[model samples]
Target: MNPTSHHQGSQRCGLDALGQFDEIVDVRTPAEYADDHIPGALNAPVLSNEERVLIGTMYAQESPFKATRLGAALVARHIAEYLETIFADRPRGWRPLIYCWRGGKRSGSMTAWFNLIGWKARQLDGGYKTWRRHVIDTLAERPAGLDCVVLTGPTGSGKTRLLQSLGAAGAQILDLEGLARHRGSLLGALPDRPQPSQRGFESALLQAIEALDPARPVFVEAESRRIGQLSLPETLLRAMHAGRCVRVRAALPQRIAFLLQDYAHLFEAPDDFGRTLERLIGLHSRQTIRDWQALIAAGRRAELFQALVETHYDPAYRRSSDSHYAGLDQAMTFDYDPTADDGHAQARALIAQLRVPA
Candidate 1:
């Protein structure tokens, strides 16, 4: 682990270190918390979802004074009994770190109350928003020595699964897609989950990378800077794009089957297929969009996919791949048999190829 990642006192504790606190609480509402929070931060929202909605309305329609008046009464009502129970029989020496969305009035009030009772407490500066950006930057500013390799390929090429395979061979791999709770595309959002906040995403990335030896290169998939709702730390994205690419190719049928497996969730709600097509409208013609939407409405996902493949995915893949085609000399492209019989031999061959000096 990087030295700075471990120091909570320096206003720079990596999310991993902070996660180790005795009490890691997220003061945001359950809805806010549900939309991807730091994995372990307990939701002890100062405001309930409805209460937050009510307060937001007050802030928008009435004056800030009115909003504060409404907010205080509720927070005090909701927390008074709870705070008493939390501090009961405990000495003032317990340490806690409290944070709100922006580390504003809500968290400040809690921190002050904790301090008044003689407890050692600190308010997270700038709140969750600040910490999030810190996670992003920490990832970008690669701790000075960690070497890395990016596994580059088109959609549905089994990049994330391959990371696990590399792990079996004792290789370091960072599954960025898994970290972001995203496969890094418009259709990448998992069926019922949201991506992590940018900060949470960065913290996860940092923790994974810190576990590896910096002197040894680690494998990661090629991804755009933004992954679903979260953005990749710019520095790390730069490093990933700049790193040598290892190409993995599967025959057409195998690639399609891999896509189906990876995006199996989408098929369950097949009728909702239009959502992705709607998102891609800006990238295509109105007529093309309508035609695809019609296919989705008719429950012809196979036809819809074929339409998308012809109109969108295939062309885009070729264009994007062409631009960065310069590094082919450094690439180690390999094919895998779709049949199970050749799996081990193929895996061994790829691993052995990776063992060669880049």
Candidate 2:
């Protein structure tokens, strides 16, 4: 775990050893760090967002010499601030992993400063880009090593809730929609929180998969290749397709009730709901869309949701599930109640059933 031992000029460190460092520092600008960074890494930006933009503009339009001088000054000021505030109480043995966008000047400068101060600091080889590439590669290869149990059902059947319950009951679960910060549907967007970049989603997925034991069955909701704007890694998608399937079924009324509770946000923002519904314009007739809109306008959400399930979602689910899952029809069917307690009970029952080998 000695930082100097792994500091062979840009030699990539094993991701499994990330925990060896006392801290992981992201030296990218606030905006870049906000978009995504290594999980648990502390932000220690070498430049502010405005400063980065100013430097880039100067570098491109004015002169590289002037830009270099200005950038150096800014980096010095920021590093001084970190030393005074964030790293003020650090011990002599403090070991930190530093990274920037591409392991270039920003992280290098910080690492040099830390080394001069006598604390061991290593620059992440290839920086954030390297870590991102690792995530993409890991996701592409890792799922094949897992024993996945794919959960398939139409919308509003409480699949996500069931996954949570199962996880709480000691089952290994992969919540892809959660990692993507989406619900894997047209109206799946969470309020205020935007979905992560594709790289961010892959990073989260890689970490989640890495934590699971490959020998045990992983319970995961069956989803289309894409979740929001992110695409599933091909290997994970293939593993889901080939995995053993479990179908959760609920009555139309029960589904509408569950959806009403789950999508309360849609009710709070009627206009946003209307706009999202417009995405289905090509599939449903104008009159049908108008009718659904009227239901939203009239606050008849349950009725509208029922209509959507009967007309749009259920049909789409049937088509996609049958086409993708070879074991769809023969899947172990679990009938779920609309209530929370019943959902947990059903999850427990499913877990017990899964324990018996097929």
Candidate 3:
């Protein structure tokens, strides 16, 4: 049975009406809020993790009446606290959009109270589940008239950095690696920052894609089906594969220099760096792994980076690019040196060239 609504004086709203509210409040537990929520929504959980668990256990082992009674007390206390603090200094005409797991009691309780207090608050009709569905569906369908200009090359080619330059010079881009918080590689994990949950990644992806103009070309780095723990939507992969291909080229010495500068953080954390190298054990011989670790121990950054590129990154990139991207042999070339000052100018030239035609 559908849960009864306590949202009085305000109607339940669909996803279409999301922009109508001044504020979006998520009333799920803190853990749920942390997992993923609306991009700009504020978390105003009605019940905490412990209290929610207690109430659920009571509902299963005891009676619904008892569970409801306990939940009501907890919800009342939380709402009272919010009124005194989080929602304290609100203006008379303020509005808020509230949601929970579904259009259920947790959010309804807050919505009812907000309306009674003279602030118009609306409950999301089907709650976050509705928005999640929209994210998935939108990502699965290719946007009409969308064109992707794919940047392809081996690692350390400054593709990501160049994409940023392109954006600075007024070109559309989708930085999948940036969104995933993973560098799209085994070693790409940021030491201090962790990757987002798959759902969170998709949410950000949809928002970024939606912000682009479909008539203009969208520049994106060539990638495999997956970026870290998140999988690229098949529709996006199709668009990327079918788009114009550009190979970013740089000399070997510059590539090594770029890697050294870009990944300087790894050098500071020796133990973690050593352990990360161990992941390549099966791919490389034990002796090769030992040599790489020794390089780390001796602080031989240049030789170590050079060996890694020649042995691992370059070969793998060749195989993947050949199989995944189209028209590589005939791809347009963009020379980029990370140490050079002409990057933005190069990006602008490429943009003009891309606008000319295939």
In terms of TM-score, which candidate is strongest?
3
Per-residue lDDT of model 1, residues 1-358, tens digit only: 2323534443323344564455655778888776545546667678999999989998998887999998998877656765767546555567666777877877777777777777766666667876666655666676444455666666556667776666666677778888888877677788776777665566677777767777677777777657787776656655665666777766656666666556657767655766666777678987888888777667566566656655777677666632443444587776653333445455556668778321
Q: What is the lDDT of residue 55 in candidate 3?
A: 99
Cα lDDT for residue 102, model 3? 79
Give the range where candidate 3 is weakest over 10 consecutive residues by summed lDDT.
1-10
Ranking by lDDT: 3, 2, 1
Each prediction's RMSD over C-alphas, in Å, is 5.6, 2.9, 3.0
Global lDDT for candidate 1? 0.67
Q: Please state the error at residue 15 of candidate 1 in Å.
A: 9.0
For model 1, the stretches where C-alpha displacement exceeds 4 angstroms are 1-20, 31-39, 49-73, 81-94, 102-105, 112-120, 143-146, 197-203, 206-212, 274-314, 337-349, 356-358
Q: On a 0 to 100 scale, what is the lDDT of residue 266 in model 1?
A: 76
Q: Tens digit of lDDT per residue, candidate 2, span 70-128?
A: 99999999999999999999999998989999888899899999989988888887788
Model 3 earns a TM-score of 0.95
Pairing residues by index, what is the TM-score of model 1? 0.70
What's the residue-level lDDT of 273 in candidate 1? 62
Query: Which runs in model 3 stand beyond 4 Å of their true positions?
Result: 1-10, 143-145, 356-358
Error of 2 at 286 (Å): 1.0
